[model samples]
Target: MSVTREKILELGENLIRTKGYNAFSYQDISSELGIKNAAVHYYFPSKENLGTSIVKTNIQRFEEMVDNMHSRKFDEWQQLDSFIKIYVKSYREQKKCLVGSLSPDYSTLSDTTKQELKRMIDIILKWLTELLDSGRAKNMFNYNDDPTSKALTIFSSLVASLQLSGIVEKVDYKSFCQSILDDLKP
Candidate 1:
Protein backbone atom coordinates (compact mmCIF):
# COMPACT_ATOMS: atom_id res chain seq x y z
CA MET A 1 0.00 0.00 0.00
CA SER A 2 1.12 3.54 -0.62
CA VAL A 3 1.76 5.78 2.38
CA THR A 4 -1.41 7.70 1.70
CA ARG A 5 -3.47 4.55 1.32
CA GLU A 6 -2.09 3.15 4.55
CA LYS A 7 -2.85 6.37 6.37
CA ILE A 8 -6.35 6.37 5.00
CA LEU A 9 -6.99 2.85 6.26
CA GLU A 10 -5.60 3.66 9.72
CA LEU A 11 -7.67 6.80 10.03
CA GLY A 12 -10.78 5.14 8.62
CA GLU A 13 -10.49 2.24 11.03
CA ASN A 14 -9.98 4.60 13.96
CA LEU A 15 -13.00 6.62 12.94
CA ILE A 16 -15.20 3.58 12.57
CA ARG A 17 -14.08 2.18 15.91
CA THR A 18 -14.41 5.43 17.84
CA LYS A 19 -17.48 6.74 16.03
CA GLY A 20 -20.14 4.52 14.54
CA TYR A 21 -19.73 3.64 10.88
CA ASN A 22 -22.57 6.04 10.00
CA ALA A 23 -21.22 8.77 12.22
CA PHE A 24 -18.25 9.66 9.98
CA SER A 25 -17.85 10.84 6.43
CA TYR A 26 -15.00 10.73 3.94
CA GLN A 27 -14.37 14.35 4.88
CA ASP A 28 -13.53 13.26 8.42
CA ILE A 29 -10.73 11.03 7.16
CA SER A 30 -9.60 13.41 4.46
CA SER A 31 -9.37 16.39 6.79
CA GLU A 32 -7.45 14.45 9.42
CA LEU A 33 -4.93 13.10 6.88
CA GLY A 34 -4.32 16.53 5.26
CA ILE A 35 -5.40 14.95 2.02
CA LYS A 36 -8.13 16.06 -0.33
CA ASN A 37 -11.47 14.26 -0.46
CA ALA A 38 -10.63 13.28 -4.02
CA ALA A 39 -7.58 11.38 -2.80
CA VAL A 40 -9.67 9.29 -0.42
CA HIS A 41 -12.14 8.79 -3.23
CA TYR A 42 -9.39 7.62 -5.53
CA TYR A 43 -8.43 4.95 -3.02
CA PHE A 44 -11.99 4.07 -2.04
CA PRO A 45 -14.59 5.30 -4.47
CA SER A 46 -17.39 5.05 -1.95
CA LYS A 47 -17.93 4.93 1.79
CA GLU A 48 -19.20 1.38 1.40
CA ASN A 49 -15.93 0.43 -0.23
CA LEU A 50 -13.97 1.93 2.62
CA GLY A 51 -16.22 0.22 5.16
CA THR A 52 -15.84 -3.15 3.48
CA SER A 53 -12.08 -2.74 3.30
CA ILE A 54 -11.90 -1.90 6.98
CA VAL A 55 -13.92 -4.96 7.93
CA LYS A 56 -11.80 -7.19 5.71
CA THR A 57 -8.63 -5.78 7.20
CA ASN A 58 -9.88 -6.45 10.71
CA ILE A 59 -10.64 -10.04 9.76
CA GLN A 60 -7.14 -10.49 8.40
CA ARG A 61 -5.55 -9.09 11.56
CA PHE A 62 -7.74 -11.28 13.77
CA GLU A 63 -6.90 -14.42 11.82
CA GLU A 64 -3.22 -13.56 12.11
CA MET A 65 -3.57 -13.19 15.87
CA VAL A 66 -5.23 -16.58 16.13
CA ASP A 67 -2.51 -18.14 14.01
CA ASN A 68 0.22 -16.56 16.10
CA MET A 69 -1.32 -17.89 19.29
CA HIS A 70 -1.53 -21.38 17.84
CA SER A 71 2.06 -21.23 16.60
CA ARG A 72 3.28 -20.23 20.04
CA LYS A 73 1.40 -23.26 21.43
CA PHE A 74 -0.83 -21.22 23.66
CA ASP A 75 -3.07 -23.43 25.73
CA GLU A 76 -6.81 -22.90 25.92
CA TRP A 77 -6.43 -20.72 29.00
CA GLN A 78 -3.72 -18.69 27.35
CA GLN A 79 -5.79 -18.41 24.19
CA LEU A 80 -8.80 -17.16 26.08
CA ASP A 81 -6.65 -14.72 28.00
CA SER A 82 -5.10 -13.44 24.81
CA PHE A 83 -8.50 -12.97 23.25
CA ILE A 84 -9.74 -11.05 26.27
CA LYS A 85 -6.70 -8.83 26.04
CA ILE A 86 -7.85 -7.66 22.60
CA TYR A 87 -11.04 -6.26 24.09
CA VAL A 88 -9.14 -4.88 27.06
CA LYS A 89 -6.92 -2.95 24.69
CA SER A 90 -9.97 -1.56 22.92
CA TYR A 91 -11.51 -0.54 26.23
CA ARG A 92 -8.35 1.24 27.29
CA GLU A 93 -8.32 3.08 23.98
CA GLN A 94 -11.98 4.04 24.49
CA LYS A 95 -12.78 2.45 21.15
CA LYS A 96 -15.12 -0.39 20.45
CA CYS A 97 -14.00 -3.45 18.53
CA LEU A 98 -14.71 -3.35 14.80
CA VAL A 99 -17.71 -5.63 15.15
CA GLY A 100 -19.20 -3.76 18.08
CA SER A 101 -18.58 -0.47 16.37
CA LEU A 102 -20.33 -1.52 13.18
CA SER A 103 -23.15 -3.54 14.69
CA PRO A 104 -25.30 -0.55 15.62
CA ASP A 105 -25.19 0.67 12.06
CA TYR A 106 -25.50 -2.81 10.58
CA SER A 107 -28.97 -2.29 9.20
CA THR A 108 -27.72 0.54 7.03
CA LEU A 109 -24.53 -1.08 5.74
CA SER A 110 -24.18 -2.12 2.13
CA ASP A 111 -24.64 -5.81 1.45
CA THR A 112 -20.94 -6.24 0.73
CA THR A 113 -19.96 -4.63 3.99
CA LYS A 114 -22.58 -6.61 5.89
CA GLN A 115 -21.29 -9.85 4.39
CA GLU A 116 -17.73 -9.00 5.35
CA LEU A 117 -18.85 -8.08 8.85
CA LYS A 118 -20.63 -11.39 9.27
CA ARG A 119 -17.61 -13.26 7.98
CA MET A 120 -15.41 -11.45 10.47
CA ILE A 121 -17.84 -12.27 13.29
CA ASP A 122 -18.11 -15.92 12.24
CA ILE A 123 -14.34 -16.32 12.23
CA ILE A 124 -14.06 -14.98 15.77
CA LEU A 125 -17.05 -17.00 17.02
CA LYS A 126 -15.79 -20.22 15.48
CA TRP A 127 -12.36 -19.78 17.02
CA LEU A 128 -13.82 -19.00 20.41
CA THR A 129 -16.22 -21.94 20.28
CA GLU A 130 -13.44 -24.35 19.42
CA LEU A 131 -11.20 -22.92 22.10
CA LEU A 132 -13.92 -23.15 24.72
CA ASP A 133 -14.68 -26.74 23.75
CA SER A 134 -11.04 -27.72 23.95
CA GLY A 135 -10.66 -26.00 27.30
CA ARG A 136 -13.61 -27.84 28.76
CA ALA A 137 -12.30 -31.19 27.50
CA LYS A 138 -8.96 -30.45 29.08
CA ASN A 139 -10.66 -29.47 32.35
CA MET A 140 -9.31 -25.97 32.01
CA PHE A 141 -12.60 -24.14 31.81
CA ASN A 142 -16.02 -24.86 33.22
CA TYR A 143 -19.43 -23.68 32.07
CA ASN A 144 -22.91 -25.20 31.87
CA ASP A 145 -23.88 -24.19 28.37
CA ASP A 146 -22.71 -25.75 25.14
CA PRO A 147 -19.42 -24.45 23.82
CA THR A 148 -21.02 -22.31 21.13
CA SER A 149 -23.50 -20.80 23.52
CA LYS A 150 -20.81 -20.12 26.06
CA ALA A 151 -18.62 -18.59 23.41
CA LEU A 152 -21.44 -16.31 22.33
CA THR A 153 -22.05 -15.30 25.91
CA ILE A 154 -18.42 -14.43 26.45
CA PHE A 155 -18.14 -12.60 23.16
CA SER A 156 -21.32 -10.64 23.76
CA SER A 157 -20.23 -9.72 27.25
CA LEU A 158 -16.88 -8.43 26.07
CA VAL A 159 -18.44 -6.32 23.35
CA ALA A 160 -21.19 -5.02 25.59
CA SER A 161 -18.65 -4.24 28.29
CA LEU A 162 -16.72 -2.00 25.96
CA GLN A 163 -19.84 -0.06 25.03
CA LEU A 164 -20.78 0.15 28.66
CA SER A 165 -17.40 1.53 29.51
CA GLY A 166 -18.19 4.53 27.35
CA ILE A 167 -21.54 5.28 28.94
CA VAL A 168 -21.04 4.07 32.49
CA GLU A 169 -18.29 6.00 34.24
CA LYS A 170 -15.54 4.38 36.30
CA VAL A 171 -15.98 0.98 34.72
CA ASP A 172 -13.07 -1.25 35.72
CA TYR A 173 -12.40 -3.28 32.60
CA LYS A 174 -9.55 -5.22 34.18
CA SER A 175 -11.72 -6.34 37.05
CA PHE A 176 -14.49 -7.04 34.55
CA CYS A 177 -12.09 -9.29 32.58
CA GLN A 178 -10.91 -11.08 35.69
CA SER A 179 -14.50 -11.84 36.59
CA ILE A 180 -14.91 -13.40 33.17
CA LEU A 181 -11.80 -15.49 33.74
CA ASP A 182 -13.01 -16.47 37.16
CA ASP A 183 -16.35 -17.56 35.71
CA LEU A 184 -14.50 -20.08 33.57
CA LYS A 185 -12.71 -21.66 36.50
CA PRO A 186 -13.77 -25.15 37.38
Candidate 2:
Protein backbone atom coordinates (compact mmCIF):
# COMPACT_ATOMS: atom_id res chain seq x y z
CA MET A 1 0.00 0.00 0.00
CA SER A 2 1.05 3.58 -0.59
CA VAL A 3 2.34 5.55 2.38
CA THR A 4 -0.70 7.79 2.24
CA ARG A 5 -3.03 4.84 2.19
CA GLU A 6 -1.22 3.27 5.11
CA LYS A 7 -1.48 6.46 7.12
CA ILE A 8 -5.17 6.71 6.37
CA LEU A 9 -5.72 3.10 7.33
CA GLU A 10 -3.79 3.46 10.58
CA LEU A 11 -5.69 6.54 11.58
CA GLY A 12 -8.99 5.12 10.49
CA GLU A 13 -8.42 1.89 12.39
CA ASN A 14 -7.60 3.77 15.58
CA LEU A 15 -10.60 6.04 15.13
CA ILE A 16 -12.96 3.18 14.53
CA ARG A 17 -11.62 1.31 17.53
CA THR A 18 -11.67 4.26 19.90
CA LYS A 19 -14.85 5.70 18.54
CA GLY A 20 -17.23 3.79 16.30
CA TYR A 21 -18.15 3.64 12.64
CA ASN A 22 -20.69 6.44 12.83
CA ALA A 23 -18.65 8.40 15.35
CA PHE A 24 -15.80 9.00 12.94
CA SER A 25 -15.63 11.11 9.82
CA TYR A 26 -13.24 11.52 6.91
CA GLN A 27 -12.48 14.92 8.35
CA ASP A 28 -11.31 13.26 11.56
CA ILE A 29 -8.76 11.18 9.70
CA SER A 30 -7.72 14.05 7.47
CA SER A 31 -7.19 16.36 10.41
CA GLU A 32 -5.24 13.76 12.38
CA LEU A 33 -3.07 12.89 9.40
CA GLY A 34 -2.42 16.55 8.60
CA ILE A 35 -3.87 16.12 5.13
CA LYS A 36 -6.65 17.64 3.14
CA ASN A 37 -10.10 16.10 3.12
CA ALA A 38 -9.61 15.79 -0.65
CA ALA A 39 -6.52 13.70 -0.05
CA VAL A 40 -8.50 11.38 2.19
CA HIS A 41 -11.13 11.30 -0.50
CA TYR A 42 -8.51 10.41 -3.06
CA TYR A 43 -7.75 7.28 -1.10
CA PHE A 44 -11.31 6.56 0.02
CA PRO A 45 -14.01 8.68 -1.53
CA SER A 46 -16.60 8.02 1.13
CA LYS A 47 -16.74 6.92 4.75
CA GLU A 48 -18.27 3.64 3.62
CA ASN A 49 -15.54 3.24 1.07
CA LEU A 50 -12.85 3.81 3.68
CA GLY A 51 -14.44 1.38 6.14
CA THR A 52 -14.81 -1.26 3.42
CA SER A 53 -11.18 -0.83 2.49
CA ILE A 54 -10.13 -1.13 6.13
CA VAL A 55 -12.10 -4.34 6.61
CA LYS A 56 -10.77 -5.80 3.37
CA THR A 57 -7.19 -4.99 4.28
CA ASN A 58 -7.51 -6.51 7.75
CA ILE A 59 -9.26 -9.61 6.38
CA GLN A 60 -6.51 -10.19 3.82
CA ARG A 61 -3.83 -9.88 6.50
CA PHE A 62 -5.60 -12.39 8.72
CA GLU A 63 -6.08 -14.86 5.86
CA GLU A 64 -2.41 -14.58 5.00
CA MET A 65 -1.50 -15.46 8.58
CA VAL A 66 -3.80 -18.50 8.44
CA ASP A 67 -2.19 -19.54 5.16
CA ASN A 68 1.20 -19.36 6.81
CA MET A 69 -0.04 -21.53 9.66
CA HIS A 70 -1.46 -24.06 7.20
CA SER A 71 1.87 -24.38 5.43
CA ARG A 72 3.49 -25.64 8.62
CA LYS A 73 3.83 -29.34 9.40
CA PHE A 74 1.77 -29.13 12.57
CA ASP A 75 -1.45 -31.09 13.02
CA GLU A 76 -4.83 -29.39 12.91
CA TRP A 77 -5.03 -28.81 16.66
CA GLN A 78 -1.55 -27.44 16.72
CA GLN A 79 -2.32 -25.16 13.81
CA LEU A 80 -5.40 -23.82 15.56
CA ASP A 81 -3.40 -23.29 18.70
CA SER A 82 -0.80 -21.36 16.78
CA PHE A 83 -3.48 -19.19 15.21
CA ILE A 84 -4.90 -18.28 18.62
CA LYS A 85 -1.41 -17.61 19.90
CA ILE A 86 -0.86 -15.10 17.12
CA TYR A 87 -3.96 -13.16 18.11
CA VAL A 88 -2.99 -13.18 21.75
CA LYS A 89 0.50 -11.98 21.02
CA SER A 90 -0.87 -9.27 18.76
CA TYR A 91 -3.27 -8.11 21.45
CA ARG A 92 -0.48 -8.12 24.01
CA GLU A 93 1.51 -5.81 21.80
CA GLN A 94 -1.06 -3.69 20.00
CA LYS A 95 -3.87 -3.79 22.56
CA LYS A 96 -6.42 -4.82 19.94
CA CYS A 97 -7.03 -6.59 16.66
CA LEU A 98 -8.19 -4.25 13.95
CA VAL A 99 -11.13 -6.43 13.08
CA GLY A 100 -11.88 -7.32 16.70
CA SER A 101 -12.03 -3.66 17.58
CA LEU A 102 -14.39 -2.90 14.74
CA SER A 103 -16.74 -5.80 15.43
CA PRO A 104 -18.71 -4.29 18.28
CA ASP A 105 -19.92 -1.43 16.14
CA TYR A 106 -20.74 -3.71 13.23
CA SER A 107 -24.49 -3.48 13.48
CA THR A 108 -24.40 0.27 12.97
CA LEU A 109 -22.11 0.32 9.97
CA SER A 110 -23.03 0.80 6.34
CA ASP A 111 -24.17 -2.19 4.32
CA THR A 112 -20.91 -2.15 2.40
CA THR A 113 -18.84 -2.17 5.60
CA LYS A 114 -21.09 -4.81 7.11
CA GLN A 115 -20.62 -7.03 4.06
CA GLU A 116 -16.88 -6.55 4.21
CA LEU A 117 -16.90 -7.49 7.90
CA LYS A 118 -18.93 -10.60 7.10
CA ARG A 119 -16.38 -11.59 4.52
CA MET A 120 -13.66 -11.41 7.15
CA ILE A 121 -15.74 -13.51 9.52
CA ASP A 122 -16.28 -16.05 6.73
CA ILE A 123 -12.57 -16.28 6.07
CA ILE A 124 -11.89 -17.00 9.76
CA LEU A 125 -14.73 -19.54 9.86
CA LYS A 126 -13.36 -21.27 6.78
CA TRP A 127 -9.93 -21.67 8.35
CA LEU A 128 -11.38 -22.92 11.61
CA THR A 129 -13.69 -25.34 9.79
CA GLU A 130 -10.81 -26.85 7.88
CA LEU A 131 -8.76 -27.24 11.02
CA LEU A 132 -11.66 -28.71 12.97
CA ASP A 133 -12.39 -31.18 10.17
CA SER A 134 -8.79 -32.28 10.15
CA GLY A 135 -8.83 -32.72 13.92
CA ARG A 136 -12.05 -34.73 13.71
CA ALA A 137 -10.43 -36.88 11.04
CA LYS A 138 -7.65 -37.62 13.50
CA ASN A 139 -10.11 -38.17 16.33
CA MET A 140 -8.72 -35.16 18.15
CA PHE A 141 -11.87 -33.08 18.25
CA ASN A 142 -15.26 -34.16 19.59
CA TYR A 143 -17.55 -31.22 19.26
CA ASN A 144 -21.29 -31.90 19.06
CA ASP A 145 -21.90 -29.10 16.55
CA ASP A 146 -21.08 -29.16 12.87
CA PRO A 147 -17.57 -28.05 11.96
CA THR A 148 -18.75 -24.74 10.53
CA SER A 149 -20.87 -23.87 13.53
CA LYS A 150 -18.18 -24.94 15.93
CA ALA A 151 -15.68 -22.86 14.03
CA LEU A 152 -17.98 -19.87 14.35
CA THR A 153 -18.24 -20.48 18.06
CA ILE A 154 -14.50 -20.62 18.44
CA PHE A 155 -14.10 -17.45 16.42
CA SER A 156 -16.69 -15.71 18.52
CA SER A 157 -14.97 -16.85 21.66
CA LEU A 158 -11.65 -15.47 20.59
CA VAL A 159 -13.09 -12.11 19.61
CA ALA A 160 -15.08 -11.89 22.83
CA SER A 161 -12.01 -12.69 24.88
CA LEU A 162 -10.06 -9.96 23.20
CA GLN A 163 -12.85 -7.44 23.83
CA LEU A 164 -13.20 -8.50 27.41
CA SER A 165 -9.48 -8.32 27.94
CA GLY A 166 -9.40 -4.78 26.65
CA ILE A 167 -12.19 -3.70 28.95
CA VAL A 168 -11.62 -5.79 32.06
CA GLU A 169 -7.92 -6.35 32.54
CA LYS A 170 -5.47 -5.78 29.77
CA VAL A 171 -2.74 -7.67 31.57
CA ASP A 172 -4.73 -10.87 31.68
CA TYR A 173 -5.44 -11.08 27.93
CA LYS A 174 -2.76 -13.64 27.22
CA SER A 175 -3.77 -15.87 30.10
CA PHE A 176 -7.41 -15.56 29.14
CA CYS A 177 -6.61 -16.58 25.56
CA GLN A 178 -4.55 -19.52 26.76
CA SER A 179 -7.44 -20.69 28.92
CA ILE A 180 -9.77 -20.50 25.94
CA LEU A 181 -7.39 -22.56 23.81
CA ASP A 182 -6.96 -25.09 26.59
CA ASP A 183 -10.71 -25.48 26.75
CA LEU A 184 -10.76 -26.16 23.02
CA LYS A 185 -8.54 -29.19 23.41
CA PRO A 186 -10.24 -32.56 23.05
Per-model TM against the reference: 0.98, 0.83
> lDDT at 42 for candidate 1?
99
lDDT of 2: 0.78
lDDT for model 1, on a 0 to 1 scale?
0.93
Model 2 alpha-carbon miss at residue 28, Å: 2.9
**Model 1 agreement with the true structure over 59-156: per-residue lDDT tens digits:** 99999999999999999999999999999999988899888899999999999999999999899999999999999999999999999999999999
lDDT of 2 by residue, 39-71 (tens): 999988888888898888888888777767668
Candidate 2: give its CA RMSD in angstroms: 2.4
Residue runs of model 2 more than 4 Å from their true location after superposition: none
lDDT against the true structure, per candidate, is 0.93, 0.78
